[model samples]
Target chain A: MKKIIMEKEAGRFCENKDIAKKLREEIIEPTIREKEPVIIDFGNVSGATQSFIHALVSNVIREYRDQAFDNLLYKNACLEIQKIISIVYNYMQLD
Target chain B: MDEKWVNVNPAQLALTAALALKVGKENAIIQSQNIPLSARYLDRMGLYNFFSTPSPFRQYRKKEPAGRFVPISIIKNGDDQSKFVTDIIPLYHLSEKNSRILSYIVGELVRNVLEHSFSEDGAVVAAQYYKESNRISFAICDTGIGLWKSLQIWHPKTDKEALSLALTPGVTGTTLELGGTSENGGAGLFFIKSIVKISRSYFVIMSGDSEYTLLKTRPDIKNRLYSDPFKDHYAFSNSISRFNGTLVAVDLKLDSTPEFQKLLDDIGDIYDSAVKESRRKPARKPKFI
Candidate 1:
């Protein structure tokens, strides 16, 4: 398993608005370079809105279509984060 | 319209909220409007839920025939506020941001009703995002302590004042009741208001006899200016109530309309009768200053 640790040291996860643009450079691009699975640790992440998660997951899914999110699950991930993501993904598929 | 809808009930709301959290807004909506649910969740609480109390069990469920506007039956005499919204609400532009505004607003509203009013039951909340119609709506109703008794903790005289004060964003009856992060009230309403303003949505709040409404013309207002915090602006209304509680409906508009003022007046009328009826019963009267 190829593991990459991306730190949201800012503690202002909600602050990342250019999430697609930011991750395109910072995380997703780097991960695709190695072409390996990744685990996003939302352990110390302060908080986030559903839009932020959509920018993250949808961008990744855009790169690799038909990719499931739990495939990269963080077992100890915050329930709040999961709930937010679940709502977004659920609604996104509607459109 | 691609599909038909059933009029919504309270049980349908729980299923809709969960389903909207699972499927896309459209499919979840098509599944059912007056969506019924299995009683497993309600049995846990043991409270007699009037809205959810299933009538005679149907011999079989009437499955949607598929590909017609699901005829939504009007559920009368029930607090199906959120269910109405969930049945026809649209949040395409805000995406999940709208949901955040709603969830936070609701969490705060629910907690307030339960804690301050000592409401013995839980309120049912529902929402929907209709892209085709370009609107979103949500309604919430509860069977317990109405607006007056809930805010009576801080403002002892009247339910209208209690109702007005609660809508004044950041009303922290939370701290006083729950010993949470805040001591006086919950800041949730304040935050919810800001989000609603930012979304440029139509927000109407009803508690007891008072109704408060706000609309944001500029979607980019928050980014444009530094803002003041939420204040209980409706205190000016002088509206009072004798009812046991409240029902609030929020709608987001996709396009500007000339009927804006009419919308506010129409909602104002919704509670006119309820508030009047509540006051008629010679309960504990309020002495206004």
Candidate 2:
């Protein structure tokens, strides 16, 4: 299992699309390919935009389909972050 | 065409010059008592170069500067874009919650330029905090393919119709990939509109050859579209204009937590109702036709 700390990767503001892409590529994609469970740790990150969460989580859901749920873990997400993640995840499922 | 000097408000003059330059009408040769002043202001802000000769009182232009009212800044790429939201907005002395709301509103508008404007020179952002008026005004502008051209991929639309669809949630002009930095949900303007609607913001979107303005007043009626009580706030207009690309301007009341929270709660309620409705509807059995 690989633990990816979002605050370390994207700093305090995890709201940029390109930064989200870098996070997805560096951590999520590689871990998912190895069929290893990846823990996305949002320990100190403050807030995120829908676009950023969409890039980080939905793109993977698009690639791995339903299996993304099994291979990924969200850790230490604040209430706001959890809400955004749920919105993006649910929106992606609609598509 | 004839050249004439028109008397207009300073802000209107600025918008006229900016729109003229945006639509490739820089050489139209019309002037105003305030147009020259507006020109000098835009020139300093790096918005338009409508004037060939510098203002006579160049020292005043330099000493006072245009940022007094219109704090204009150009955002070229992603780095400036992020810094503008996370860093610059907090300097205005707003509450944390207010900062977040402004950040979301401004971020969404500017992100639209990054994702869809496709302008070579990038987008321009301008904002003003009117302390006396208890409001903040700002605009995000781009010189790329206009809304009509972008949404033509989905279907042919007049500039007015394009503005309508752009404000409608789940409607996108292009087939953007599901996710990856780009704004994929097509909810940028929709969210901003809802925010403005709740916060009693005066909002305007100018693109192609049409402009749309929504003015909020007397909080009586619900905004049917967003399911929020934006009632008695129904000063909406769709007019013909010659602006190219897209320009979104907003003047929202400062510190509107109640309105903003109501918007969020409304969205959550709608989402819950949708899920419950979907669960209630039974799946249909497959039948040969």
Docking class for model 2 is acceptable
Score each candidate by Cα lDDT. Answer: 0.42, 0.65
lDDT of 1 by residue, B1-289 (tens): 1133324433344333332333333443232234344532222222122234333334444433222112222221213323422332222234433433443444444444444544333454544444576665555545456666655546646655665455442234533322112112233343344445544666655555556665554644332111222231222243544334565555655343322223223222322332233224377879899
Alpha-carbon runs more than 4 Å astray in model 2: B1-51, B60-70, B176-183, B222-239, B259-262, B271-289
Off by over 4 Å in 1: A1-95, B1-96, B174-185, B216-242, B253-289
Q: Worst ten-residue run, lDDT, model 1 chain B?
A: B177-186
* Candidate 2: tens digits of C-alpha lDDT, residues B1-289: 1133323322343354455445554454444444544344445544444434343445553534332344456677778888887667767767766777777777677778887888765667777666787787888777788898878865745777777667655556766333222336665676677668667667888887777777774467554334221222444445555666778888888755444455655554454333334234388999999
Per-model TM-score, in order, reads 0.41, 0.78
The weakest ten consecutive residues by lDDT in model 2 chain A span: A86-95
The prediction achieving the highest lDDT against the true structure is: 2
Give candidate 2's error at residue B257 in angstroms. 3.5
